[model samples]
Target: MPVRPLSPELAEKARNELNETDENKMVDSLQHLKDWLAKQPYLKARTDDQWLAAFLRGCKFSLERTKQKIDLFYTLKKTAPELTPLKYKDPKFSEILDLGVSIVLPKTSNPAEPRILLMRPGLYDPNKYSLGDVMSVGAVIQNIMLMDDDNFVVAGGISIIDLQGCTMAHFAQMNPMLMKKMTVAFQEAAPVRMKGVHYLNTPPGFETIFNFIKGFLNEKNKKRLYVHNTDFESLYKYLPKEVLPTEYGGNAGTAREFTENTKKKILEYSAWLDEEHLYGTEESKRPGKPKTAEELFGVEGSFRQLQKVIMIRELSPDLAHIAKTELNEDPKQTPEDIKHLREWIMKQTHLKARTDHQWLVAMLRGCKFSLERVKEKLDLYYTLRTTSPEVTLRLKPTQPTFINFLRLGTCIILPKATTGLHPRVILIRAGRYDPEKNSVADIMCILYYMVQILVMEDDSATVIGTKIVVDYEGTTLNHLVQANVTLLRKIVAVSQDSLPLRLKGSHHLNVPSGIETIFKLVSAFISEKAKQRLKIHKSADELFEHIPKDVMPPEYGGNGATVAENIEYWITKIREYKSWMEVEERLGTDESRRLGSLPSDEAGDKGSFRQLNID
Candidate 1:
């Protein structure tokens, strides 16, 4: 959680418009809203304090407007479940997501820079997934961005709707009522400040859909909409090509690649989307009579039109060839392999393992489809969880201390992995440690959680091994004292013997003077084979020879994103899997159910293990 420094321009805007120039005012505003909302019985949705502050900021710190928008936000969820559905896992919704209809661009010029959302309705099939589904997918993406405190709150958003191949049939398929619902939801319910909407290459008869949509938008937003009919030059006047994707004559990757990456992100945050669905207003529990859909929107039959026949888009020869190549190159496990692995695990009565296909596939891929190895790893994996309560039971991610440790960016899994080996890179900012707050056990717990998540996310490339970059720029003798030798041994033992991953390479960057003593103490516990893979680099430039700079964060003179942004991405991902992690507490090998007794040397004595200190 790096503190986003407010630009002078943004600071002035906050002072003049929102009257919130400092932390104290923001805190007071948030507290005021929380107290006000506590008295509103109808507003049942669990509101985050940070989100409340965002709402206040959006409304220029006007409490009355904020309250109104909050009420309408939950109300829209109840009335427009079609577009604001409770879940994104629905098959049709997922299809739209997979089709790459809409995506939020990755890089922003600055912290206060507005995000550009690119939408290509021409590439999708309206017959298979409706226009409402497209809007729903976009809404989900917007909601996820809104959760980012720095990106959406400080900066706003802009949209580029490419209508190059839109046909009259597509317009006929559009449900005006659904369009109205989506428009109202975006304008009133969502906290996003839509700076503008650019329509690219608008085809003939596009006015039919445009007019219908504009009828619902407010005058302010209606003025913000721009129709650029085939004039890329004019569109570039408003949005520079530097910020746009290559397909749109921008520097980023191809539009197809951007869309695919966006789909992956949507899937990564699906759990968060599902949790959001639960926070909406529970209409059934309302004290007053709930408003009916018909009463709210008037007779819906007025906006109904003849449903046109759905048709799938035909891919061009180049795109078709690329799709084929991608399908072949994808390293994900096949359906048949997943099925076989699931069946094999279930049939192994001695293992007493009950797991999903995903978990099994991860293990199988880690072992390169070796069932015996996967089984062994699975047994050890669950055994460690069941036996070592300190690592699994006491490692609660929701705890404040754990979250603070995570925010320190002490350890993060880079988005991209190594090129040749494709092992996921785990960057450990050892210099960021504060021994006063975090102990050796705390560090071990965090490492355990990171490895657990990395293994789960790993495929063939990353599962086999992982690359670790340790930064020891700020090491002191006190830090070495905090690194308990006993705990270090336990961590190394479990990683080597139980975990399925291999330590492919370990690069120590920014090694402080006399830090070799600390490494010597810790290395004594690690095996010689592991020690052989470790390299001590005095500079990031030296480390770049072994680990490519492209995959490393920019803070280390790499081409990738800033360290803060990368850390934020992983934090959001960790929060998304919070529920699953909680369930994992009960998921471990059942020693009582095993056929044979535990091994004498391997098994822990009944009362020898130390007790976990829960804060």
Candidate 2:
């Protein structure tokens, strides 16, 4: 079923069930603020509604100690009466309260409904927005937070030191240097580590601590500081140098340098994040170690070496051939080229390179360089074709022989049939001795020629033609002669099924000539009792005399051959005698009466005197 438009009732139901109200009020408000800011002239900085929202949040959270919170809110509220909601915005207050609630928000959970007090800046005209103008609200929030007192930790060397107060005694007591070093080492040694410094009693002013951190960070004795995290509440306690350490000695180990460098990097990172917000996990924040080649080149490194190898291999012939030639010429190549080739080979771990021969073959096949140039350019990549017996077993579609067989449409007598060789044998003698091409041509030509002769001509002509061709080719013929004989036998077998037709006193004998040859050849080859029977009926004259003999008698060799031959001969004779019988019948008065009145002996004489139809 197609979806229908939602009805008012359904919309109202959804709203009530979801308890929806001002679903995107915050976002809408932010967008309005952004529009207003965009319309401004001078005050309009390079910022959007999201930036405004973040800035507003920072001002509320950092400006009034609104983010501070005590673990025991109820106890703190009782013990410190000033810890009321109104006092939560006090610049001196450190603890912030979170009202409990449950409403999921993206990127953050809202169980702790923290609220920050905020006030609009009283300075100005709102219609001065301009392109590229920036409102440093986050920077302002950071500044305000730094002005307020908060616990501060400065990490350096192997320690994270408490920078709450300025005194050697306190510094030694806190051991900030050792703490900083430990923090760095711990992170390096283990997968994860964290350390914190707390200032619960007396919070120092922001500038005093900030200046101290700056000095500590500038100290040359401190070890390098790799990573750091700072909260806005404690920003005031940090030294200016802690924000950017690069300013000190082009490094970020000292508090001063860390602060300076970080401020810049974060500013740049923030701008980038705003432009391209590809948010991910904390791990993704850290840049990966530079690749070796990439580090060496500094700029976009050149991969030409690897690319060249690939191109050469792609263009080269099978590496096997190259390797074979190389091995033949010089088994030992130069050390450097060999080493380079080996390195290249090692890089291609997918190749089975356990043996030197295998490795060489792989290289020859993988790379385009010739094996001959292995020493000079170090060639690789050689491939070889493969064959399988499975190919023979595969069933493929082919045209039927009758359909594909081409007919010459013209027939010729065998060039030398009087002799013994078949036509195919003669063609083989004339054609080149190429088993692949010439032999196939000869087979096709002889087969087609045989078919034409069998189907078009009388038996004698076919026999004479085939015989002459066989004789011409002589005994030099091989398989062609055998194929010819087989083909001839097939033609003879087919002819046996054709209908016999009578013409005049003779009958059209449908027996194929090749069948006669086939029988003769088989008789000659087998030398069985059937051979004698076959020879006796080689012609109709020989068989006609034996028609009266019992077909199954030993006199006719006790085989079907004599009867079959006599039957065939009589059929031919009857066909030839047709016209005479027809004329006699048509001219019934005289000829038919005479023929009908003739005695058995006279009739036999007349029939015997009739013209013989010999093929």
Would you list the C-alpha lDDT of every candidate in the order shown?
A: 0.66, 0.25
User: 310-415, model 1: which lDDT tens digit per residue?
Assistant: 1112223543343235323122334455566566667655454545444554555455566666666677666656666565455577666677777888887776
User: 559, model 1: CA deviation in Å?
Assistant: 51
lDDT, candidate 2, 167-207, per-residue tens = 22232222233322222222321111112222211221222
**lDDT accuracy of residue 132 in candidate 2:** 7
Question: What's the distance in Å from true for residue 309, model 2?
Answer: 78
Cα deviation of 217 in candidate 1 (Å)? 1.9
Candidate 1 off by > 4 Å: 1-12, 109-111, 267-270, 284-289, 300-615
TM-scores for every candidate against the unseen true structure = 0.46, 0.14
Q: Which ten residues in a row have the lowest lDDT in candidate 2?
A: 380-389
